[model samples]
Target: MAETAALAVTPAGVATRRTVTGMLHSWDLSTGVDGPGTRFVAFLAGCPLRCLYCHNPDTRYLRDGGRTPAEEIVREAAKYTGFIHASGGGATVSGGEPLLQPLFTAELLHRFKHELGLHTALDTSGFLGGRATDALLADTDLVLLDIKSWDRALYRHLTGRELAPTLAFARRLADLGKEVWVRFVLVPHLTDAAENIEGVAAFTASLGNVARVDVLPFHKLGAAKWRALGLDFTLADTPAPTADQTAAARAVFAAHGLQTV
Candidate 1:
């Protein structure tokens, strides 16, 4: 595949030439990953979390995606500005992990807001932290935070990482009064337990800024990506979550008055 054109902006109002690497393209009128409405999604390269059910394994590499300058992405996505605004949509910077590229995402969001007056959203796993995270959130308009598993043990098991930091980060985001859309993958026999769901619901309710909750049914879409990369797929035998399973989990949040869908 050919690389995307370069678009770079320096701090002093200078635009530099560069090339975009590992850039993937998508132009669909479907609902945002969080909900309904057309969105121009930019799937950033790399991720720190390794959720067992992650479907975008290709996105986990640190630098697999080409170095598409922030300006280039903003420019390309700008084409859909009209439709995005009219439909109450905007650019969503998702990732292997968008938080990993805070500077780039910030630039994109800043440009989209200041230049195009477009809404901006970040779909994050709530993992990355410290100064980088703070900078990214500073410019983000809305956040789609994925609370993988409520139980600390299960969270570590699912993503091979600690959960406390992510939970704390969520609280911090809430304290900042940022609009948050909490999402959880309904993984049957793993993450959809009644207790876990309730625990997540309670935690989110405590935050008070979680505008909505989403129950994304577990799928194997990332299995292929794993295979292509010559890695063993762990969830090969795992089946996708059924509608009833997802509905039941969604009900847990709704029952807690969490406005889940």
Candidate 2:
């Protein structure tokens, strides 16, 4: 019985436990949600922002994703180590706002790294950069930093928050040499203005540490999610960004010598 109990730990501490709250979604351990390439991703619960174009309306509320324990998630992910390794992918903790649940986010990433030997990435708006602890930074391998808009007014209008902190976070992360993929959603006239895109590209260029830039064309895929949540869809009539618009915007960043994905 003692030997049986000892055997249960497995290579990744399978018997050890950790706490988690809300839904933990996983996919090909190498591809990322942002594009193709298998990746094991956990969409955590809760967020502080109220973006007008948010598609993950189901993740906005802290309680919406439901409660889940961390150990169970780690154990389940452990089962796919071979898949993760084979696909040249790792694990990513994304969210309504993964930063909102930093403790859980850090803990999960640490387990994946130290226990499971997995490459880990964090997808966040960096809205809570200062609020995040050093411990969290120490364990994160990469960051997907989303800059909603260049203009503060437009930022507040779109995300219901200020833009300074996000920029500050970007700078700090760069200073620390953290690999970051800057994410900008092309939201038609809202975030697609030439001046706004210029400013955003300038900011990203200034960082000098950006690994790549991702121009995500805005879509209404999450509109139904907002409706389901009984929330007013402010951009309900806003048309999605066109391919030409996205390509044009991508050109702006390319002009700065930044690689686009």
Write the residue-wise lDDT of candidate 2 on 8-93 in tens digits.
35597677443444344333343555422466788887788989888887877676665566676788789988888777777888
TM per model?
0.86, 0.88
Q: Give every collision pair in model 1.
A: 21-66, 21-67, 22-65, 22-66, 55-222
Best by TM-score: 2
> Which regions of candidate 1 are displaced past 4 Å?
1-30, 34-36, 132-135
What Cα-based lDDT does every candidate model obtain? Answer: 0.77, 0.80
Candidate 1, residue 23: the lDDT equals 44
lDDT of 2 at 4: 9
Candidate 1 on 83-154: residue-level lDDT in tens? Answer: 887888777777777667666666666676777776778788778854346656776788888898899999
User: Any runs in candidate 2 off by more than 4 Å, and if so which?
Assistant: 1-30, 34-36
Worst 10 residues of 2 by lDDT: 1-10
The deviation in Å at residue 147 for candidate 2 is: 0.4
How many steric clashes between backbone atoms does each model show? 5, 10
